[model samples]
Target: MATNITWHPNLTYQERSELINQKGATIWLTGLSASGKSTIACALEQLLLKEKVTAYRLDGDNIRFGLNKDLGFSEKDRVENIRRIAEVSKLFADSCSIAVTSFISPYREDRDKARELHLNSNLKFIEVFVDVPLEVAEKRDPKGLYKKAREGVIKDFTGISAPYEAPIKPEIHIRTDLLSVEESALQIYNYLKEHNVL
Candidate 1:
């Protein structure tokens, strides 16, 4: 909205990586609610931190309470919520820190847009599909959101009232319904390692 402002350029990405001792990337975890995205993202962050890798997690509900407080669950709001998070994560990656985002970004278009943003900036964008059956996610709903959706207390709920489009070619696919949280986290860590993103 501030069109008067011009872009400012400073250090190059490689220069920032040198200063921070590591390159940065965005680990985008998307799935249906309660598909273990947050749990796996938390574990991944912990694992990376333990290995001396600087990392941060951008959680959906947490961001809603803060940066996206004005947004709601409507389709337009959801799109904006994801767009804002993608921008924030891009900034984090530019700063040479891993940005782990755990959101049920249900639409493929939104997810693709996020990926395009990172790719355009020459930053690594690792799309991680935290996959589980709808029934499994509903059954393991720790926050009872699925229950609320089922009871008609919630609107535009993913995997119920709304749709959840699975990633067609995510860099990493996690079957959380079959894998433990630790395993899922380690799987991603291994991917980052193999891809030289960590």
Candidate 2:
């Protein structure tokens, strides 16, 4: 069944980029739950829009409500969830739009696979690690997920029952426990500018 698909596109990636007046890229924000990934992503989107950049954000919960609605919190499902998001993000990047993805994609291999996908396509893949202590994240549990996980209402919760392997050398690392949301977003924006991704 897979072999039945054929590759075809009307416009070249470069043409799409030229028309948009900006290059395509994927900015993947990963960390534990309540680690400020979504907040920073939101700010980053606003910042990019102010500069007239075509940026789109694919957040975890929002995507689960739609594209990944059937996926659960099991390890296998989590991997599949990220895989689907990565493919969609690549599509956005191919179209000359910046794709900002915020996910607690807790495993190193999973995150690396996403990066490899973009690299294979010659697209920019920026991995931004939102660093925060587990205690800090629990304290700022805006969605009350940590409390639920602690009560056994949730299973395979990253940083609780599950594991979150920190990135060894991500493109950007923001310590949310030390930095404000605006500061974190600006740091990512600066990275895009310095790397000529903007």
Candidate 3:
């Protein structure tokens, strides 16, 4: 921690939303590898943008290339990565833009911490569990991560080596195998509409 550190107050969330005609929230998509988190997130962002809603995607691999470059897949590093993501998503929500985050955030504790951060800030934290069976995920492994994990080439892989703590009561539980990408995005969009996230 730094000495003499203090938070400078800025425009209120309501004020910003009034000016921008948009209220911000975070739709956090969590699941195992190949569970369609990123794909659904991408579709949701596109749909929101087309409807004139300000939205941005914070992809796991993309964030690792930049904002979280120093972080690795270790348990400690993963925790820190989520902490940073929570902070960044809060900033976006405060700026009156939806933060669509796609990550295989396997730990319940870390996800709960992120939810707490948004709750404290008076922002919406929509937990979307893109759930798929382990066998289904392995079959759909676009990155071959499941195969690598099975071969012992990848360590600490969720649903393979590491554990994925499924959400007990996620706001949205999407079954990608049952729904198309468009339908999945529509489901989230409908949730936002119903919850008055506009």
RMSD of each: 0.8, 1.0, 0.7
Each model's TM-score, in the order given?
Answer: 0.98, 0.97, 0.98
Q: Over the stretch 16-116, how does candidate 3's per-residue lDDT look in tens digits?
A: 99998999999999999899999999999999999999999998767999999999999999999999999999999989899999999889999999999
Q: Which pairs of residues have clashing backbones in candidate 3? A: none
Q: What's model 1's TM-score?
A: 0.98
Q: Model 2: per-residue lDDT, tens digit, 1-198?
A: 488888876998888878768899999999999999999999999999999999999997679999999999899999999999999999999889999999999989998999999999999999999999999999999999999999999988899999999999999999999999999999999999998997
* Decreasing lDDT order of the candidates: 3, 1, 2
Sequence-dependent TM-score of model 3: 0.98
Q: Which of the two candidates, 1 or 2, achieves a greater TM-score against the reference?
A: 1
| Candidate 1 Cα outliers beyond 4 Å, as residue runs | none
lDDT of 1 by residue, 67-174 (tens): 999999899999999999999999999999999999999999999999999999999999999999999988998999999999999988999999989999999999
Model 1: lDDT equals 0.94
Backbone clash pairs for candidate 2 read: none
The stretch of ten residues in a row with the least summed lDDT in candidate 1 is 1-10
lDDT of each: 0.94, 0.94, 0.94
